[model samples]
Target: MAALKTSTTWIKGQEFESEHDGNKINVDGDKKNGHGPKALLLSGLAGCSGIDVVDILHKMKVEFSDFSIDVEADQTEEHPKVFKDIQVTYRLKTATDNLEKVKKAINLSLDKYCGVSAMLKKNSAINYTVEILN
Candidate 1:
């Protein structure tokens, strides 16, 4: 048997919830009005790519003092829907400042890893770039 749970969610005067694992995420339609879903999606992408990059970079023995992922999103002009294009910029600031290695790490994330990226790329153009700042 499969277990299920309901997670509450609301947007744009609509009411709904996410259901899984016998739990619920309720959406009261207060703070999260029109931008909650997109925020969650973007967060997923960042987290997915984040884990991959960190793991790959660690395995590659690339020491970084700081790291950050910047996601810039573009919404459609039409109503009742949005997000036509989203640009993801992966900025990795390391002490060594190896551009090639950093770029390679990012490529690996977008191509091999990062399930969110793979899925989103099918619907939208997600271009990623890496900048190594020392």
Candidate 2:
């Protein structure tokens, strides 16, 4: 088991700073000013799965020139809004022959490796697609 800790403190109107593992992240309620909590959560999901995919692919000897993830999520209209649906698009620049291996790596991340995905999926439905550019 692992224990993680974080602290958040208000900076100003609708803005705050979150500290974790010696890093600080600025969060704002106004989307135009900075990332809101929900948006950050979506980014976390993508980052978590992206890290997993990279490690899995490396272990499998799959090579890629570039990789990125794009995520969009729908939120409930009611108070205490939460994500309803989330979609992730993984874009990779790699050899055509590695497409199947890349997909397998993504599947492993989404289905088994990403803790962020597991937590969010308890409330949100997640779907994903892949795009390979060679």
lDDT of every predicted structure (CA atoms): 0.74, 0.92
Clashing pairs in 1: 5-19, 6-24, 7-17, 7-18, 7-25, 8-25, 8-26, 8-27, 9-16
Worst 10 residues of 2 by lDDT: 30-39
Could you give me the TM-score of model 1 versus the true structure? 0.73
List the candidate 2 regions with Cα displacement exceeding 4 Å: none
lDDT by residue for model 2 (1-134), tens: 78888999998999999999989999999975679998899999999999999999999999897799999998899988888999999999988888899889998998899999999989999999999986
How many clashes in each structure? Answer: 9, 0
For TM-score, the strongest prediction is: 2
Reference-based TM-score of each model: 0.73, 0.94
Where model 1 places Cα greater than 4 Å from the true spot, the runs are 1-6, 9-35
Which candidate ranks first by lDDT, i.e. highest?
A: 2
Residue 97 in model 1: lDDT: 49
lDDT of 1 by residue, 14-65 (tens): 5456656666544433535333567668877988988898998899998885
